[model samples]
Target: MFKVRVLNEEVIKQVIDMKQVVGAIEEVYRLKSNEKTEVFDMVFHEFERGVADMDIKSGHLKGEDIFGLKVVSWFKDNEDKKLPMLIGTTMVFDSKTGMPIGMLNAEYITGMRTGAAGAIGAKYLARENSADLLMVGAGHQATFQIAATLISMQNIKNVRIYDPIDSNNAKKLAESMKELLKDKFLSKYENTDLYDEISKKFNVNFEGVDDLEKAVKISDVIITATPSRKPLIKKEWVKKGTHFSCVGSDMNGKQEIDENILACARVYVDDMNQALDVGEIEIGIKNKTISKEDIICEIGDVIVGKEKGRLSEDDITVYDTTGIALQDLMTSKIVLDAAKEKNLGVVVDL
Candidate 1:
């Protein structure tokens, strides 16, 4: 067996840019068109009575680089140390012989897959004339979300970022994004004249939106990446034709948008079972604001042409991203393939 250690951040970057990963997802979505893909069978272990526990989810899919197992572990109250609330690893097997082919650090995979899902959602659901983007969080996922969206939808010209605690972090993120585009194409990504033109065309003003409500109101597409127990973006602030990508709130009790927002919008999810269990949709279900039948489609469904996307020009759309194991497996497959082509990884025998 060959062993490789893929770091979290590096895997995140590779997975974000790899078009093969997105292609794999699109193929899977096409096969499971309009239908909710079968959820992975889960095994739960209780450590303590109510507060402590862990769960392992296992599943299989038929597509490129098929057949895999992802095991995620959850432990609460780890926030004091700045570590992830839940952490684990995933193992991918060779579909032909069932040999263990590779292992990946799950944290990075989760962030990248979630961000990619948002980008895919924006690609299909956002308006074709979309030019300005408003991001609500300045974290790692936010960076990748912008990267994926920029790659998939090449029309974006202005990006407005807002983070309550660290506005400078948002600016730093914008600068880094600019730097990436510069390094890749050898030119400045954002020009002052272009920014001015986009700002005028979109009527966007990032100056006065000190709070979440105002920031969300003006953008064509808004991405909420904050980890909040309470709703951060108000429903009233969301206008018609606005596309919202909820990348945060993958855990229960964490929510970014109001439950009422789901009631008024066409809601899509990465995985229905996972989202209902712990994603933003869980809060809407718990509050009875939206029913189980309210979900429109999965992002994968839209990608594969199984379901309709953006039915109306003025429809309000939201993508509830909970992250999925298949995404990790597919992205890892792409990375491994690339590594083989470029002789990137150390081929240590196991």
Candidate 2:
């Protein structure tokens, strides 16, 4: 009754595939819409204001018979000590027995699940013929976002990356993505095969851009994954029928798009309460530019057919992702299941 499996980042990398994780996330969303899952209120704390912070995200997946919590922290100066700036740990429990079943490193799961969320947003909300994508922010998360997008949306033929802090970051990420697609360089079988097939079939192009406005205007889909506190994209620059997956702004003060965009767009959130508190739409709601009623519905609602996504070709759609706990919980189960089949994790008596 006290045995627990331990999975480190390395083991997690071997067992969890992005394609499977994407499917898991899609199921989680549907479960959420059907009231079969519950995401508890996220608890956030800052070690030092503006320097470091931590968040505890917990949820119950009643349909899956599991529940879990993920603790993620970000330390701005951790690089000075040769530590990753972002670190996370996730604990999973059996719902029926209420016993801890698994513990694992959460960094990879965090990135992949969030990437899937962004891609799913585009899949449901973006125009059917959407081809060009502009990624706003060229960080580690940006790579996963692009990979998941390519895996989910085969129509995307061009990807442009922009980092407000430096153009070099965008250039580096562009090169890395191009190499990844060309070589099918991932360890996961499904992802590797998909990348290889995509590279051979599509003339995919990746570019690093300095002109954010021009990139936004021409792109069919724009995904932002930065940690910016101010708006990096303007409302006037955005064209009609464009879809935006706002992946940043998971904190009280962080923002990426102008609030004016929400005024005219059909906005959807991962969770209404979390979105109003810390998502891309938070600023707009705070400034009275948009109210809670402005949000059409949760993305899960659309996924479950409870609501429509992208009502018209001329309608702008925005998905405000606040990083829900249900995503981590569902993805953890996938990793745990895979690890068990391959006998890839360490088992310890608790």
Candidate 3:
């Protein structure tokens, strides 16, 4: 007597829009800050081969119509095998009766929602005049971070990108971004100076940079989205009034920035429970550089007025995100609704 809609990555892409995601994730943060949601703790499992790992993140929406669960995997050999690094799905159900309503490909959703969270974090925590952005990764997640930041912040002048393993990865990111961004502005320039002309016309420049120190030193807001066991960004290179959004440390013992950065920076997290356990904040706490109490507040609390985000323009702020479940759940609600409205997925009787 019922049916469920199934969506794949291609179908999900048809409905993927950055502006909608940013707005939806922000709305969920308010709901969470007011104590109207339940985001469960994440569970991790390692395959026997020891080269692959899976993460399970689930959550419920109070007084809403849907809940979601996201299961994702990271395999070390994926690139070697010519496979996708991120493979996951989102399972959505009716909140009232516990009936399944939809299932969707989650790779894009996970990256997009995480990107939106960082952009929202920047909106409240970064200096108003923040323009230059330094993205320390050139993979799939880094692209989302750049695209979403450009949407959230206006008058941005420069974006500097770096990747450790593949220098070409950064160059490819710049070209892809140019294609994605060309439609946002009107262009009348020659082929030789197309990139510079586009930047001059839009007053924004995004490109790949080889010097990591120079990138960090000149940036107003820095976003780290790489999976690195060692610290990549140093505290000394970070300028005053800079904001850093650490998005890659979703697993235990993974770090992306120098712990000393958190010692001096006014730190914020998506959720204290998760951030203290696995996020970049966990590194600072483990090293005794800073304690949980040292964290200024959760980004959600800043949205609901329970705590302030950044007190001064000169304040150094760091937001450590562990990929909240509520973000996945709420974002899926929006994606599923849009898919249904557009008739974009396959429906089957259950």
Total backbone clashes of model 1?
A: 0
**Which digits, one per residue and each the tens of the lDDT, describe model 1 over residues 90-121?**
77766657766676677666655666777777
Model 1 root mean square deviation, Cα atoms: 5.3
Q: Return the candidate ranking by lDDT, descending.
A: 2, 3, 1
Task: Between candidates 1 and 2, name the one with more favorable TM-score.
Answer: 2
Model 1 scores a TM of: 0.80
Task: Give candidate 2's TM-score.
Answer: 0.95
Query: Candidates ranked by TM-score, best first?
Result: 2, 3, 1
Better of 2 and 3 by lDDT: 2
TM-score on alpha carbons, each prediction: 0.80, 0.95, 0.91
Output the worst ten-in-a-row residue range by lDDT, candidate 3.
184-193
Runs of candidate 1 exceeding 4 Å displacement: 1-18, 34-38, 43-55, 72-87, 180-209, 348-350
Cα lDDT tens digits, model 2, 147-185, are 778777868889999999999999888877866644332
* TM-score of model 3 (CA atoms): 0.91
Error of 1 at 245 (Å): 1.2
